[model samples]
Target: MASSCTKLCLQCRSLLCSKTVASTWKYATRAHHCAAGTRIPVHFLNGFSVLNEDQKTTQTRLRWKQQMLYYSNLSAIHQTTEVKENKDSEELSKANVVVYQNPLLPVDAVPVTESQMSLDLDAAAELSALEEISDEEAVGISVPFALPPASTSLRDYVDQSETLSKLVQLGVNLWKLEQRPNVGSMLLRLNFNTDVAPRLLFLKEVGVENSRFGYIITHNPFILTESLENLQARVDYLKSKKFSSETVASMVSRAPYLLNFSVKRLDNRLGFYQQQLQLSATNTRDVVARLPRLLCGSLEPVKENLKVCEIELGFKQNEIQHIVLAVPKVLTANKRKLTQIFDFIHNTMKVPHHLIVKFPQVLNAKFLRIRERHLFLEYLGRAQYDPTLPSYISPERLVSLPDETFCVQLALATLDDFYLFQKTL
Candidate 1:
């Protein structure tokens, strides 16, 4: 009986040990699965029924500790992952950054030192100071007020009574000033005593009459802006071109814009007329002195007229030169009118080109007048232009004589008869 009891007791002890070990094994497996973020099997929890009350309490406490440890480990892992992601994002941002470099600087250029930089600044300051001093010296005195901006209107300065008074004293009336607001605006900026008076004095010295100052300035206010030296140089150039002092003065008075032309321009114009017309220097000077405005306009008309006189009118080069010497304005005459006059004289009047050259003034007469007179003379059987023939009329007398004089003297008829004859045409 005793031997049988011992074997049974050992079997019972072995069964209890196996149950405890199985329960512990299941509990450990569940904790491991929970920690690994996997699902805990429901069968693993059933093993806890085999345990005693004390063992169950201890097993419950162990499970609770394991769950807490598992959650703590999960939080640590999640924080580590977030830190890694942030580090990667920072690296990507660093890769995307761009750096800029100036292309103008030389690759080997040295950075400027402080001393050199300070010296450059000082030199710039000195240059600006010197410029200011030079400006004061150029004006010959300190300016009382700031000069008006370039865009300021002349009307704005019109309210300034002193400026208007000075302009009035110079004979530039309000009407004249209004005629050229641009000139008046520029004049408003000038110092009257230093800038304006000197130009007036210079004009006087150049033989521009004092009485004509108002006319000259009104016609060409820009003359006041020209430098004295330049005005003198232009006068000298005219004198050098064989124009007398009085002739130069008279030319300036007649054509205020003539001096506005550069010396080279005047020379070219004189040379062109002289070379084209084949005139002597003295004759060229005489022509320009008589017609100063000839120097002002384009030479193209003059050129076209020369070609017409030579090619169309059949005037020899020498004959053209003679005509131009007699009538300097003929060079600038309308090309079509000139052609018509030549056509009438040559084709209708049977007048020779040489005779036309002898009286180039005939070219200056109105075409209708020339035609009427020639037709009248032709009616009278007195239009014989041959110098060798009897009762031959010079071309000059044909056109130059007044209507009454032409009828009685050249046409050899009464004025009433001439008028009657004109009505028939």
Candidate 2:
């Protein structure tokens, strides 16, 4: 058996050594490189193993062909993958543009090309010549008349004037005089051309303080141009209302526009407060002194607010007066806010009616502040919702204290907790 096996191996070796098989072996070996990157696996090489030498030789050939086919398929796959990646990259490079077709053109219209540029040159030249002639006829060739010389002299004159200097110092831009050339003449007439010193003395006589007159004039330069008779009448009206000279000066300083108000306008505003609102002379003066602009506003709205507070919201005449005296701003509150506040105080908080009159300033408190303080106190068991149960903390104490003092003394909650509670709400 061993001799037969040896003989069979010799015969197989001889057959494998023939020219055709030898050529195929040499071609396969040369074409298929075995390197670290492309080494054949041991399992793959063993897959062709056989006990018979002839079978082994045939299997080795089949394995080589299988490996070659696998490598060919792998190369084909890699090339296809590269081609797909390049195509994808090209697609990515293209921008996503929204193209709208021209409504006048056909949807499938072919793009114009350079060959379509051929045109009749002589006809184009004649058309251009005709257009030029039409344009020439339509447009007259008159030269622009010389512009009026820039007002160098007026600017130079203003730059030299002491009065103009004073105005410029008070934030008045003289460059604006370009728009109102008459203002230049007005300034010149008031400061230099007219008797300004006597008029200034007259203003002093009218209770305009010497120190404050400059500010008044600076604010309303027209005051200098106003007739002395008209000025005196306005001043006389204020004096007739029992406003002292000091008060008049202070009012003028606070609102220079008051001087510009006519006697009839002034009387109307004063009468509204004194007659319609029935504010006493003292209260009227206090309201005006506190907020001079109050008189400048329309009386009808203020009257309506006062009426709502007194007649509809059940605030007494004297209580309204107290609110005005304490916080004159409260009288200016809108009707809805006035009603809401009254309701919140009288119905919601269960505060006594007379108590509000006693502390009208509580009405002046912001509704949010009043609500926060009251609710916090109720939470702390320091305030009773029932009006009959005397409050542990007075409404005055609740609203009046600053945040830190209120937290430490009244709410007894940490500042963080109080602020956090506010944010949550």
Candidate 3:
């Protein structure tokens, strides 16, 4: 039996391999390959096995021509094996995706594939015995070794398929993430190839702290040429860089929210928006995603009389199925004018007794207060611009509107001791 199997291995090898492959052997049961990948068992069709029982059991195997049906079955089995190998390769690639660094993952190493599978030497000999069946004797030959067309270069093909699949997954996740307001455009932004591998290794070394972020990294790996951690470390080395979490949060709040930018700039927002833009219901109360219907209700419809247009105002998740309020391009531009108009309130225009937010919102006859003056601008800015309020005192008709991004840039740009936006506000 061993001798017969050995003869079959030698014979079938030529039919199975490239002419370049130096004598491909049926892998010995005891022989091992360090990176053999995986092998799977395939059950032949029951009917084929039953019908071929006599032929399979026969010691004097029919020449290839005499056993066309058996050869056809063998060809089918080979094709199935090829498909199985491709699938195994795909799965192996997925599992070995380098996990991001954190306590969850600690190190990086080579990818491995293993399976407790053994191929029958008798079956291999049976395949080998088919090699002697000449094409004329067999009626036809099915060449398993007839390689696929050489259109896809070996290196490029592997990389294009593997890396592209992983990258596509990453892009989809990022698209989903962009729907959230704060971090819509956040992604690794890989600039180079050399940078990618190390960054991937770093993630595998550190393990991503945020699993969502980590998942993105594992699939679409990127390495920053310069470590952000090192930059953060150097910041502390230079000065007392650390601040309280509360302080940071407060700072962010005070850091000039660019609510009203240009309509053109607003149009540019599609690029930034991710799919998952989760905002806390508590902190950002009465969250206004876009503008109200008082802006453009006439264009859409007359649902619940959108004239003056503010439906679903007092909502609690129920009783509200989205109100397609008019997007207020006019109010946005007008409210922008109000920033300067609010500032102009102290010197230029007179604040009416009823229009409290026009100037000194929180008591005292003067335009400013001692304790509340620094933060007073924020309160008045919102009060003067709050779309919900029934304000006959419109700052919309002002001469000039402050550019919100410029206002933000100007506000944050300088290291001035005093608030620069105070003048603009």
Candidate 4:
């Protein structure tokens, strides 16, 4: 039994030695190919020829452990290199991204260091520890102009001189200054005695009231920038065209931008109106003074309305002049609206253009209101508008009177009836 057991042990040891040699030989061949030109130890190649069988097995086990450790460390180093590469790529992509910033918002201050923050805290503490001084003990520091309190409006800040103060008293407020900052800044740089006062005095000399100075300036700030010589020239041109000083003042006050027109431009506008309306110089001055805005914008609207009156509405030249003289607004009224009103009056109401000239206010009333009232009157059989008739209802009163007044006075109907009629329409 002992001999058989010894034989079994020897056979198992021989089998283990054969497997270890085979694995070692395979590993060494692979390592030689992978390392290319690396030298192998003589004992490793010779398969531990000098060592005994037990020693050879022990050395084989140690070599296998060392190779396994080397492979694990190599895998760990490869994974670490890939992770570092990925981290660097992510940082580069983040650097390429763009961030947007709004121009209107205030920029953030630089980050405060710990030492700087500590110093700031110390400074604040020292400041708080300082004693407060009385107003009498405070030193008076004179500046070019006294800055107003922060609580006051921007106008207060702008009113640094007596001239600016006078403007504030008149009517220029913070809103007006902000709306035209360029003009406000220009005024600030101007000398009151040399630049602004002369213009104020000129406006006054032209007969503009002191109270109107604010209104004029607020409406047309460019008036301040106009040279006194140019302003005088404009005023002189108006006077030369037979405009009285009071008429010129009224025109300027009503349309503060009037003096901004050059002498040639003013003459051209006056001549155009005179020629178009067949007005004498006196009548032209009166018409222009009544409606100064006529010379303000483009004359294309005026020309179109004139064509509408003559060609479309079939008004003669003289009748057109009478209509304009009565209501100067007729010249600037929307062409289509003017035609609609004239069509309803001439064809629907059987009123003549001659009658419209006398009561031009009919053209200014809303078209729907005119239609409702006229239809109501026609329904009652009291729509007689002829002056020769006994129950003559003037075209002016038809539009000018309120609903209640028209119902009671002109229509001879109750307010309820008129309101009911309007709703039905």
Best by TM-score: 4
TM-scores of the candidates in the order shown: 0.57, 0.49, 0.19, 0.61
User: Candidates 2 and 3: which is better by TM-score?
Assistant: 2
What are the clashing pairs of model 1? Answer: none
lDDT of 2 by residue, 323-416 (tens): 7777777757777876777788788778876777777777767888888877776666776534466545666776788988988887778887
lDDT of each: 0.72, 0.62, 0.31, 0.74
Candidate 1's TM-score: 0.57
Q: Enumerate residue pairs that collide in model 2.
A: none
lDDT by residue for model 3 over 126-186, one digit each (tens)? 5465466766857775554432344322222323344333444433344433344433222
Which residues of candidate 3, in runs, are more than 4 Å off?
1-164, 167-223, 228-230, 234-239, 244-425
Score residue 359 of candidate 1 by CA lDDT: 86
Ordered list by TM-score, greatest first: 4, 1, 2, 3
Q: Cα deviation in Å at residue 394, candidate 4?
A: 1.4
**lDDT, candidate 4, 1-425, per-residue tens:** 99999999999768655433453455445444433322222234433212123424554545444444443343343344444554566653332221111111112212344555565566667633368866764565344677654422346555565666767777765476656547656656667677778898999999999888888888887788899889999999888877888888999999989999999998899899999899987788778889998877689999999998899889899988988888898999998899899889999999987898889889888999899999999999999999999899999999989889999998898999998988888
Q: Pick out the ten consecutive residues of candidate 4 with the lowest summed lDDT.
A: 98-107
